[model samples]
Target: MADYLNNNAGMDWDDAIENDGQEFIILPEGDYNFTVTDFERGRFPGSAKMSPCNKATLTLQVKTEDGIASIRTDLILNRVVEFRISAFFRCIGQKKHGERLVMDWNKVVGSRGRAHFKPRTYTDRDGNERQANDVDRFYDYDEKNFPAEDDWMEITGDADDLPFN
Candidate 1:
């Protein structure tokens, strides 16, 4: 591993080239915990699936049995795919059921969530087959959305329960 860069001083390209690069990980189909490592906003040209629109590219660090897998996913920001945008916010606790929330991309990084990942096979433009990971669903694991049982009060209102309350 190379030493941390302080101010780009003493940087050597040949020396850095010796360091090994990250390995590609394709996990089996299952749910996994993932953190938003990076976020980028970009425009998407019109495709046959949908019209041109803005998109959010997310770099997720997914925890897998082998190790942490880096998966890059693009989220198209359109009403046609609004469910996916809502799911991401709900999973990260930014949005709750029956509530409205502003899309805050600033806080997206470092947010944690659970999602289902599946292996997908596709052909490259060069005519080569490749295997990659795809997100099946983003789950809502926000604790604040669901009140705990202990926080609930049974409305019997017994005299003895009054003291405990």
Candidate 2:
């Protein structure tokens, strides 16, 4: 973080506040198990396809041989994307197919699921190109997809019981 503030404070890549090394993890486009590490409730303004509605932004963390990759996905609470909402829930075991259930955002974090992530290239508003991973599809949770005991990623630090300050 210090390096980012010191050297890379501006748009110039040559400048860096500090030399904080960066690791780029490029996940292949395929099926992978992921855990919901974060969730946020947000609102979306009306768009051409639908009216303004509540949105669930989820941060999914996938463990791989290289490292951990974080991908964010937004579930728009609108009829146009209703199937996506249902699919996400089903993938995380929060809901079953052919069933109606309330979206319990409280239990989202720490939940594991399966998804197909693919690389995406998009031009930013500034016309600069950017590379990112997008959730191409969500697969229903299955026993075969569950990670083995040795596959779990160990996160450093111990703040499990502490409340956010």
Tell me, by TM-score, which candidate is best: 2
User: Per-residue lDDT of 42-63 in model 1, one digit per residue for the tens?
Assistant: 9989788889999999988875
- Per-candidate RMSD vs. true structure? 11.3, 7.2
lDDT of 2 by residue, 40-83 (tens): 89999988879999998898888777777888889999988899
Which sections of candidate 1 miss by over 4 Å? 1-16, 143-165
Give per-residue lDDT, candidate 1, residue 133.
91
lDDT of 2: 0.83
TM-score of each: 0.75, 0.77
Q: Cα lDDT of all candidates, in order?
A: 0.80, 0.83
